[model samples]
Structures are given as C-alpha cells and as structure tokens.
Target: MDLLKRRLDIAHVIAREFLGIQEKGEQNLLECWLQEDERHRMEYEEIRQLLVAGEEAWKELEDGDLVAAACWQELQREEKRRSQWWVVWYRYASIVVLMLAVGIYYFAKQESPETIIHVETAAVTPGGGKAQLTLADGRKMQLDDTIRLTFKEVGGTDVSLEVGVVKYSGVDTADRKGAYNTLTVPRGGEFALVLADGTRIWLNSESSLKYPVAFTGNERRVEMTGEVYFEVARNAAAPFVVEVRDMDVRVLGTCFNVTAYGANVVTTLVEGSVRLNRGEEHITLSPDQQGTWNGDKFEMREVDAQSAVLWKEGIFYFENDPLEVILETMARWYDVGVFYADPELKNMHFSVKIKRYENINKILGIIAQTNRVRFEIKDRVINVYE
Candidate 1:
C-alpha cells in the first residue's frame, strides 16, 4: 500500500507535466525520479504511448485492468506531495491502466466542448494539373488531358503545350508591342510553365501569371497573382522582375517562391538573392530567408526554404502552424470552403506532415486524433467543431 502511494505520487507529477500543467523548473523532480531507476523511465514511456493511443485502444486497456478507487484517491492527494511526504513506489497492473485513463480524462477536460458535433466523410479527390491560357487577342483556351493545343506562334513566340506543361520559346518580338499571355490555375488545380525568357515557374492552385510572349523592354517583367515557384534565367542586362500582389520581386538570376494569397505576399528565397520592392521601401533577401508583406509593412524571417516550397514537390509540410492557417491552405488545394463550427477551434496548433495528394478525409482523420477537435464535410465545405 505504501509503495503504491509513492508510485502514484511520481505518476501524478509526470502526468501534470505531460498535460502542461506543471512549470518548467518542476521537471527536475520527474527527471530525478526517472534517473533513480531504469524501470521508472520504462514505465513513463509506457504511459506516454498509451495516452497518445486511440480512444478505442484506451477503453480496451481500461477494461483489461484499472482500479478507479485508488486512482481517484491518488489524484486528490497529487498536490499534497509537492509540500510534503516521501515514499517508495512501484507500478502495478491496476495503476498502470488507471494512469492511462487519467491522462485521457485530463486532456479531455482541457478541451471541454461548449457544443458537440459529430462528423466524418469519404475522401474528396485531390487537385491535379489544370489551367486556362488567355492569348494576347483575349482568346481563352482550357489546358487539360482532353484538350491539346498547338500554336505555331503567339505574337512572334513559339508556343507548345505538351502533357501538363506549357513552353513558350523566344523569338524576335521587337517588331511587336503590347502582346501578352496569361495562365490561370483555378481551385483544385496546378500548372507548370517555361517562359520565353527561359525562366521556369510552377503555379499553385488559385493563381494566375501574366507575361509577354517575348522579352522586349528594359527589364523582363511579369505580373502575377497567386503562388509561384520561380527559377529565373540569368540575364544581368535585363533583370527578371515578378509583380505579385502588393510587391515586386527583382532577380538577376535566382530560385525563389512567392505566395500572394488574399491581401498578403510572402516571398521565400531558395537560392541566389532577390530584392523585394514595395513603393520606396526595398529589402534584400538571402537564401533560406522569407519576406512577408502584410499590407502595411514587411517582416523578414529565416525559414526552411525546402519546407516553404514543398507544395511544388507534392507535399504539405506544416511546421507548428495554427489550424486556421492549415485549413486555408487546404481550402485552396482541395477546392473546399472551410468553416469552423466553433470558432475557437481555429487557434489550435498542429505540426503535420502529409502528402499533398492524399485524400481530404485521410488528412482530417489524422488531425481528429488529437482530441482537440472534429471535422465534418458537407458537399465542398468543411466544418470544424469541438
């Protein structure tokens, strides 16, 4: 009995820390407890795994063994041990199972729901290579598996559409003026393009890029709205400039990514260097650095360039992002409207790594396991609740 009490005391401290109820300095006690015996560390690991296991697995564990009475008693005296009482303790079958249930209960209490909603659905299809091309004469053509477009020349530029990529070859266009082409990728779609300037670009969903059929001016300039990853061709004589949202990205030769969604513009540099100009304010960004223009001002931060450009590589890599932000990305990729049934659920944080091509429901199922929220899909809308 005495040993059981001491084990419960250690369990209480570990549980509190795991649940984020204890302060950082308080971790010393748990560390000392673990170092005192190898079995202590093993026991803690077991408890941790059980806590993160599925709800059904936990119920099965509870049925296998758990003494509710003893666990309830130890939970009551949890705080009393911080001020006094020292004893020897060991793990038993009942306490082991009971501790797992207690961890779940604590997590559940932390996310108490003001309202309850149940939801789940089949996997919605993923986005694919699709877009629309508008010619200089204002003629729109759809690019898909069925529609094959072969244009010999678009205002002195040779254009070829093959598979999912569009290539525009350079030609003497000094004789021509005011001729441009625009490529628009709608929701649940993406496309690739090689401009006449030799720059390669990958366009994300809900984005558009407008460029001249051939470079002719003092600078090779393109206007874009949406998201694009660029590998600008080296041309010191005529610097490549991309006008996106409220900012202009100027590059002599570089690889970078620009996301101009809603009212904000985020430019992430992958290689070489680029200058971001918004009115008179200009900032230079190095490799692995990102510049965010939030309407009024620019904020610079160092980020993992690969992670920022993962969308082009067919992956969704979210590094400790908030739920609302993740859902916003999902909305564009899956072509769905996201609504929070409970607005408060939007603030929850998630560090997730999932393939961009995965089914929508599969992604939601993984997130729902966090126990912080649930999701429902109706038609093309996703509703999140607690």
Candidate 2:
C-alpha cells in the first residue's frame, strides 16, 4: 500500500510539473525521488522530452485564436480541481501523465491572445453499424442500424437483418452447397454477422468478409480483408479457417481478432487455440498470444489479446503506438485522410484510451494537448504539424 501511494505521489508530482503548476515542495520531492534511482531519472527525462516536444509543436500555430482562448479559460478552472482528478496508477502511469500534462499545458498556455490560434473545419461524425451485403447472385443490399427485415438469398437460404446484424439460417444444406455471401464494411462503418454455422463475427471499418451461406463440407472457411473479430461456434468435426492474403488461421472453435489491413496479418487469440499456416510453415497460438505473418516469416508475441478487440466495444485503445499508426486507424474509422507536414512527427509514440464515437475534433484535441502535434481539418482531410 505504501509503495502504491509512493508511485501515485510521484505521478501527481510529475503531472503537476508537466502542467507547470508544481509547488516548490513537490519539486524538491520529485528531485529527491529522481536521485534515489537511475531508472527513475531516466523515466523523468523521457517524459520531460515528450512534454518539450509538445511545447515545440504548439509554437507552429497562429496567434489570437478564439477557440484557444476559450479552451485556456476552461482548463484554468479544471486546474483548481486537480486534487480531485483521477490518478491512473499503473506501469504506464508516467506516459499517461505525460499526455495529460502536455494536453493541459497546451490549453493552459494559450491564455494570452498572442499565443492563441483559430481553426475552422466541418464537423466530422463517428462511424456506426453499416455495411453492404452481397449475395451469391451478386445482389447488393445496404444494411444499417435502422433497418430490420428478413429476406431470402438466391440459393433459397433464409437471411435476416435485425439490430444491425445480418444472419444466415434455415438453408437446405444440399441445395446451397457452394453458395457464398459477402459483407463489405466501408470506411466510417462497421457491421456484425452470424454465419449459418453459428459463428459470430464483428467487422471493422474498411473490411470485408466472404463466407458460405451453409456448411456443406468437412471444413468451414471464410475469406476476409481488413480487420475482423470472431467467436467461432464449437464444432469438433468441422474446423473453421480464416483465409487472409498469404496465410490461413485454423481453429475448431475459438474467439480471436484478425487484422489484415496492411502487409502484415495479425491474429490475436482471445480464447481457445488457433493454428496459423503459410505454405508449409505453421504456428499455433494460445490465448493472449498474437501471431503476425509479415509476408515471409511469422512472429509470435504475448499480449493483452482482449485489447485488440476493443473496437468491437466502441473504444480505441492504443498502447505505445506511433502517431502515424494511430492516425491511420482514425482515418479509416472516421473516413478521413491524413497528411503530416513533418514526417518525423509520425514517429511520436503515445498511449491513448478514448471512446470510438466521440467527435473527431475532441479526439484531435486530446492529442493536441500533448503539444507534440496540432491538426487542421480541411474538407475531410486531417493535416498534422509539429
């Protein structure tokens, strides 16, 4: 308990320092703590550098902005209630505090009219449950949260759309032997589905999945691009396979997330076991393990597998990810484009947890607080600068 308190106290001190509100006593305490261990000093330096980077970025914005002045005033009021603020005490506390401090400083320092900057952009809304369903006969039907109905596929398979999910059922297995359906989730949209075999799938934005209307053989396979989370129904006799560009993930029944948006194909296992195969090279993954097939070789690593599927839960959780990677994800979900003025800024790393449904500006504001980067939205493109 004392150890935990000490860590929390250190976080508070560091946060105050980042906000430029640390008292003399807190500064002395932090200095003493820094002298106690080399690791502590290193941690402090790393966070300080990040904060400094943010400060430098803020200098790029134009002055006398109305929005910056309003934000500065609001943040000043928040600072008075700093003691009541929630302190997230964990291994990542230092990094989290750095983000908080940079954000607070970014707003707080804009109090002077000469330092304020104004930005104008159209409101960008969040993505929702929407997708395009293509039947075996190539008929396309649009699906969204508002639509609810039951329809029959060309192969006489019963397909239903209710509560944003497209489900396949009641098909004569013999008649719909090779009939296939595809769910295409476009940028700024997401969708869910239940296969005839009872496997549940959640597709992320800019993703597509092609599956059979009915299971008629010894194996069930689905071809997919982009990202998808699956909860395969248990079927010992018939194995389930997810086919990516160059690899296949085989499983009897399991819950896992597959990300195939780029050159790399990543499979994060949440429950049960999965075997990944590429040509003759194959690897098995256990729960909480992630397998990445980067065209040639496959690499495995242990991770918080559940974190990989947070998109299904309406959250964006990034852990020590680069700015470019994070923005790429945001671009897909928000259906926007990104351009960075300083390419080096793309390498800035951050850890963030934010609601997926929040306005794009709110998300950008949080990152802007870090002072590491400022964003300008024109048309539907997000321009980033250091």
Ten consecutive residues with minimal summed lDDT in candidate 1? Answer: 84-93
State each model's CA lDDT, in order: 0.78, 0.81
> What is the per-residue lDDT of model 1 for residues 11-77, given as tens digits with 9 covering 90 to 100?
6676566556765666897788678756568768977776556344345654665465554446447
Task: Give candidate 1's total backbone clashes.
Answer: 0
Residue-wise C-alpha lDDT for candidate 2, range 162-197, written one tens digit per residue = 987998888653576667889999999999999977
Quality of model 1 by C-alpha lDDT: 0.78
**What TM-scores do the predictions have?**
0.74, 0.73
Model 2 Cα shift for residue 132 (angstroms): 0.7
Which candidate tops TM-score? 1
Candidate 2 TM-score to native: 0.73
